[model samples]
Structures are given as structure tokens and as C-alpha cells.
Target: MRQEKKSEKQEEKNKECLADLHTTDPRDDKERIKQTKGGLLEDSSNWILKHDDFRRWRNNDEARLL
Candidate 1:
């Protein structure tokens, strides 16, 4: 779908732009994504997990994603 292709292109662009970025902290990536991409599609939250679970994964790297 077009959305998938756009996401892939944006991801590739971000990778190239940030290849020189070196930091264990994920704050930079999160900030960069917030700037470059639209916040979230309407109703997209329902496509994945519940809001609380999503928040957990967003904050905790050790959390399992399914």
C-alpha cells in the first residue's frame, strides 16, 4: 500500500540522515520522528495494542512487542 511505501521511504531517509548519529539514548530518534512524521493517523492506535501497552513499549526497551 502507499502508506507502507511512504513509511519505508521515510525510514530509509531517516537512516541515512542519522547514520552518523551515535547515542544509546533514544530521545534524539524520538524527537526526530516527531518532527519529520505526522503524529499518528486517525484510529491507528486501535490497529496495534492498547494505549497502556503501547506506552510501555514506547518507554521500556525490555518490553515484549507482539
Candidate 2:
């Protein structure tokens, strides 16, 4: 009874948290993809190049090294 109601509230809270986690800001996704794919490989590669850890490894670098 009371336990069931509490569980339901907890479930709703969890759902809201999950929804928040899943919702992507469009700009963030675009930046993520730009950083991911080697498409940022150019003289103007600001975002990807700025991320030191990400820039340290490429597809080939990962395969051959780490």
C-alpha cells in the first residue's frame, strides 16, 4: 500500500532522470560527432584539437598503440 506508492514515486523519479540523460542538446551531439569522426581533421579543427586526450589518439593510433 504505502510501500507501493513510494515505489511508484521512485520509479517516476528514475524515469525523469533517464529522460534527462537521454535528451541530447543538438549542439552537443553535433560537437561530439565532429570530435568523433576524423572529419575534424583540418587546419581549422578547433574543437577536436583542443581536447588533448581525444586528439592524442586516432583510429590508426588506437589500433596500432592503445
**Which ranges of candidate 1 are over 4 A from the true structure?**
20-66
Candidate 2 lDDT by residue in tens digits, 1-66: 999999999999999999988967899887989888845556675777678676566544656654
Question: What lDDT is reached at residue 66 by model 1?
Answer: 44
Please name the candidate that would achieve the greatest TM-score relative to the true structure. Answer: 2
Q: How many residue pairs clash in each candidate?
A: 0, 0
TM-score, prediction 1:
0.30
Instruction: Summarize candidate 1's per-residue lDDT along 1-66 as a digit string, tens digits.
Output: 999999999999999879867555678777777788955457866756667767777789666454
lDDT of 1: 0.76
- TM agreement with the true structure for every prediction: 0.30, 0.38
Give the residue spans of candidate 2 off by over 4 A.
25-66
